[model samples]
Every structure is written in structure tokens, then in C-alpha cells.
Target: MKILVLLGALALAGCASKPVPPDWQADAKGALDGFTDDYLKGNTAAAEAEFRQARLATTATGRADHVAQVELVRCAAQAASLVFEDCPGYATLAADATATQRAYADYLAGRWQGLDPELLPEQHRPVLAGGPIGAVADPLARLVAAGAAFKAGRITPEGIAQAVETASNQGWRRPLLTWLGIQAQRADAAGDAAAATQIRRRIALAAGQR
Candidate 1:
């Protein structure tokens, strides 16, 4: 009697819980990874196509938060590559974003005031605390920190060097060339003509112009 009734209710509740569709999950993850890989390798057209597929898969979930998260992934990759454009996609969904997502968005945009470090990924947490960028273990995380620090006008020559090294080590040509160009400009500004010329050669080599 009572046991049977309770069992029926429990079964009904379980049936009502919708599981995530496997296809959506696979499509989203695969496309996002493809986009990141292509973008980092400087394949702009392929990255754009992959990102479109990712967005479509995420949008199928009918969850604004999920869509916003995909946008954040794109923004983070762009940040790591030193492209500091406004994260317009995330901005559109911001009102529906979770507190942590909003905080991450702000962090990517270099808006540090009132930012909650705990809301950020562990690798990015130290950046908010003014800790050394070299302390971040992951190469991509280090590049991300360097981009943020550059946005905040807080990046030093050492920080730029670390970012250049990280990108070069990873064979991330896009960011490597960008960082090398910046290093060259810094050297030129300081009247280090020899150093600037050397950096320019590295940039040319990285750009496949050599």
C-alpha cells in the first residue's frame, strides 16, 4: 500500500528528470575543441565554421547559461591569443549568466574592480591577486594571464617573454607572432635596436615570411 504508492511517486519523479542529449553533448564538445585548435593554429576560416557548429549545438539545449558558457570559451581562447575585443557574445547573454560566469567575463575584459577571484579558474586566480604570471603552470593559462595583464597595463617585459615562450613551445603561431611583435616594439621603444632587429627576425620566421 504505502510502499507501493511511494515507489510510484519516485518513479514518476525520475521519469520527469530530463537527461542531456548525447548528440548535443558530443557536438558541442567536439566543435568547441576543433574551434580552439584551429583558432590557435591561425586557421580563421575553419575556426569560424567550428564555432558556428558549437553554438548551434549549445543553443539546442535551450539554456542561456549553456550558450553563455560556449561564448566564454571562445572569448578565453581569443584572450590567450592577445585579441582583447569586447566579448560581445557573452555580453548579450550576460543578464542570464550565473555569478561565476559574469565574473569570468569581467576578468576576461580586464575589469578587475570588485572581481571575485574565487569565481575564476585556479590558473587565473593569481592574476587577480597581482601574483607572478610565471607561477601559473599551464602554458595557455600563462598566455591568458599575460593578455589580461597587458589589458590592465600591468604586464612587464618578463611577462611578455613568458607569454612568447609559452606560445612558441605550444607552436601556437598566432599568439607567438603577436607577442613577438609586441616584444619588438618594446625593444624599439627602449632604443635596443639590436634586440628589436632580432625579435623582428623571429617574428618573420614565425609568420612564415622568412
Candidate 2:
């Protein structure tokens, strides 16, 4: 009986280890390619539909979703006009100049988010952290700490607003801008009209002409 039980478990494990279905990758890639084509043609709805279908196909149990691929294609299509002035291939993707430029800016912002700000080398940690707070000096880590503070209402909106301004001035983008917006909303809820107005102005100014 024990031997039979062991054999059953082994068989189950073997079945579970089966390789991913070959069709999934090919189907996902094709769908992603279709999304890009539709986007390039300015068919936003059709591109979005293709991307959604591709996401579903890529979500198979044993396969990784092709989220990055789909997102890149969509970004390339939708924000083509906003590519930052510094992008390498900006000249070639000028068909939808405005959307491409925006896509590049978003791409850079997304790339910044992926970096583990806290884990940066020591010299860079203080800059990212916004100050020297021992452990939370890494700017991203400080942002997480700020969130917890906000949730607990332990830190005042005024304080968070200051941090956001400092971080934004440091050339950090989304994280700083996001926190500033949060602080503004929080101030509004607390009826601190002065603080809320100031934060809103800061956000608008930070957004610049872009």
C-alpha cells in the first residue's frame, strides 16, 4: 500500500511537470504583433482588443504573461508623440511623433519604478532616500514608509508634502509626483485649503509644458 501511494505521488508530480503547450507562445506573440500593427495604424480600439486577447493567452498556468511586450506595443502606439527629446531612435518612430514621445517618457518612468531604490549603493541611497534617516534613507523605501504613515495618519500631510517636493527637486519623477498628489488629496479631505492649494500648484508646475 505504501509503495502504491509513493508511485501515485510520483506520477502526479511528473504530470504536473509537463512542458508548457507550444501553441501558447506562438499565439501570444502573434497577438502582440497584431496589437502593434493596429496601433501603428491608429486603430486604438482594435489594438487594445488584440492586447487583451494576447494577455489572456499568455496567462496560461505554466506560462508567463507577455505583459511587457503588450504594454510596450501599446505605449509605442498611444504615446508616440511624447517620446523624450533624448530617445535614441526618435527619428525613426516619428510617424506618430506625439504619441511616441509620450511613450518614451512613460517608458523611462516605468524603468525608474522597477529599480530597487533602497538597494542602491550607499552613495546613492541618501539621494534616493531624500535624507539620512538611517534605514529609510533610500527614497523608494522612504516612500513606502510614508504610505504606512499616511495609512496610520501618523504623519501629517504637510510633512509628506515637504518630502515630495524635496524628492521631486532631486529629479525623481513618478514616486515624488505621486506622493505629492496624495498629500494634496489628503489635505483637501482634512479641510486644509491652504496646504491643498499649494500642493496642487506644485503638481501642475512640476508637470511643466509636457
Q: What is the lDDT of candidate 2?
A: 0.46
Model 2 off-target regions past 4 Å?
Answer: 1-135, 148-159
Compose the digit string of candidate 1's lDDT tens values, residues 1-210. 011110111121234377644677667777777887788889999999998998998798889887888888888789888898798998899999888888878887888888889988777888788888888887767877888888777888888999999899989999999999999999989999999999999988999998
Task: Name the lDDT value of residue 170 in candidate 2.
Answer: 48
Q: Assess the local accuracy of residue 203 in candidate 2 as a C-alpha lDDT between 0 and 100.
A: 75
Per-residue lDDT tens digits for candidate 2, residues 1-210, read 011110111122235477654665556666666765564344568877887876666556322213343343343333222222333333333343343233333333333333354433343234233443224544433443444333323445454755575456545444456667778778898999998898788777766623
Clashing residue pairs, candidate 1?
none
Local distance difference test, per candidate? 0.80, 0.46
The estimated TM-scores of all candidates read 0.88, 0.32
RMSD of each: 9.6, 18.0
Q: For residue 65, give model 1's deviation from the true position in Å.
A: 0.8
Off by over 4 Å in 1: 1-21
